[model samples]
Target: MNLIQGYDPDTLRELVDERECAERLAEIESQRSLPVLLERVWLLKVLDRLDEALELAEETVRQARMAGTRKDLLRARVLHATVLQNRGAHAAAAQELAHCANEAEGRGWFGIAAFAHQHHGRNAYEAHDFDVARESFKRSLFLRREAGADDTELEKALRAIDAAERRSAEAPGVLV
Candidate 1:
């Protein structure tokens, strides 16, 4: 199996240096592979290339919907949600992520389920719906914990929940 198969895209992202990642991802995209396209979109999202990511994610969603596989569909949906979140469309992002979470949970894709919840948490946080943010972050924390996500991510999620709760409880009218 190739390195791409041996390692999850998220982990591989961490391993690759930021400066060179785009080049590597571009090589993968040259193959015109669906999964690779989704991965590239994800990488673009992470790199803050929001518009480009959105374009790829939209295409990924269309293609994955045609495939009719729950896993592929969920992946594309999650990426689309993430790109939407990057673009500040929090409500729609949450809707997309919630759909992905429902499907991934049903299919027992624990990691995808966790990521979906995490994306929802991020959307809620960005929207300043702190109560919902806290709930979503807590839900994501639980799911990510069950998925065996690294302690760093679990701790970060917990911290995010705490922070959101703190932000929510702060005296209103103060610039948070």
Candidate 2:
């Protein structure tokens, strides 16, 4: 299976075309490679099949640990954490993503680090911790710039920060 065509996480999230995801999932159903597993995890998550997503995410992590490279393992873990976040295990997701972001940054994988920080910010945003979300989003923006990400990515980070700031300002008992 060609893993490059339809598995971009950013595109998946931005478009959120359920039929497209379902078709892709069907196409990849028999593939058990790490990349395919990762794609499956994301597809399931986006399709709102959270239980299946979490299960496949856990399996993907295990497979990455056994056979994939460190970068692959980190990518698997990030997806696993995102599934956790989507499943409402906010604290667990935050902890996992914090480790991921730190590890990615330490290894100078700025693109991966930015992705982790961006999702970490999303987790905090969903939990209504707007301050943390804004801080994380800002960090993601910095990391994205460090990675020389494209304008689309940078704009997404900027938008996330703005959203967090707006939420913080509108929240009750928030000072600003």
Candidate 3:
């Protein structure tokens, strides 16, 4: 549980070995490293081991709260919401993301705020709420750009926006 030895969120997302990440993180569970726990949850989700991911996510949120660290708690909440989103629980995910987005904004954590809004957009897109998805993605992109986020994040936001727009155009009852 070396505080200085952890992967960045972007690196975790880009990792080709999800199972390795999960195992490596789990090995440090005794150390109670919040970052490792959160990353493990993300890796589990990527592996489509939703039940394990959800369990770890909930535990991470609880541990983060008990640790009295706002940053860790915010990160845990976002990861938890992502598990819910992956599980197709859109409403719950959206609710969590909304709260997360507001909290991150109030705390001036623009990176987390951007992440929250991006997932919020993903939830909306899954629910076929293209307009809401588009707006959320736009907000996310703005925040990411303002915060000097990496190009990967900006590209992801743009892709979400494009997907929402394409969906909106194809939906019935839309003007041609």
Candidate 4:
């Protein structure tokens, strides 16, 4: 697996034929090729084949751990947990991301911690547990801002959490 230099959707063409992309990347295993496969997985998620995307994401996380240093593990964990959350396995996803948060915190990866928080917030929101979402979203936004991804998904999560809170508060105990 190659290193991810950066995430530029435009340059990488966010959605592409996965098989072709994988083949192309396998042709030349550079320090920048693995991210292309990861990008394919992201595109797969966007296309709604979440199971396949989750599989690819898990593979990406595994390969990234093998190929990357501690510095890169931060990004790998974030991506993997994001895929899990996308699959709507909210509780499991949250637990996995919590592990990522702990690892990032131990490694002084504040940025990763922020993203993990945001993913955890997604998990909570999907589970219809607004209180946890509120707290997680708030932390995610704070950390993303500090990490320079001020306009990232973390911010979007904040918006979603706010909307969820409003809806939940108005419902008056619907009794799940």
How well is each residue in 47-166 modelled by candidate 4, as lDDT tens digits? 567888788777777778888677566666677777777776777788888888778767767787877776676667667777787787787777777667756455465575575577
- The Cα local distance difference test for each model comes to 0.76, 0.87, 0.82, 0.66
- What digit string (tens of lDDT, one per residue) describes model 1 on residues 1-176? 12222212221122334556667666776766687888789778766788989988888889888864778888888889888887889888988888888888888788888878877876787787778878887888888888899987787677778777777887386576
Off by over 4 Å in 4: 1-32, 148-158, 174-176
Candidate 2 lDDT tens digits, 13-122: 33466777789999889999888899999899888899999999999999999999988998999999999998999999999999999999999999999999999998
lDDT assessment of candidate 2? 0.87
Q: For each candidate, what TM-score against the reference?
A: 0.78, 0.90, 0.82, 0.70
Candidate with the larger lDDT of 1 and 4 = 1
Candidate 3, residues 150-176, lDDT tens digits: the string is 987788788778878988898998587
Task: Give me the displacement of residue 11 in model 3, in angstroms.
Answer: 21
lDDT of 3: 0.82
Model 3 clash pairs?
none
Q: Report the CA-based lDDT of candidate 1 relative to the real structure.
A: 0.76
Residue 26 in model 4: shift from native, Å?
14
RMSD of each: 5.6, 4.0, 5.2, 6.7
Cα TM-score of candidate 2: 0.90
Per-model tally of clashing residue pairs: 0, 0, 0, 0
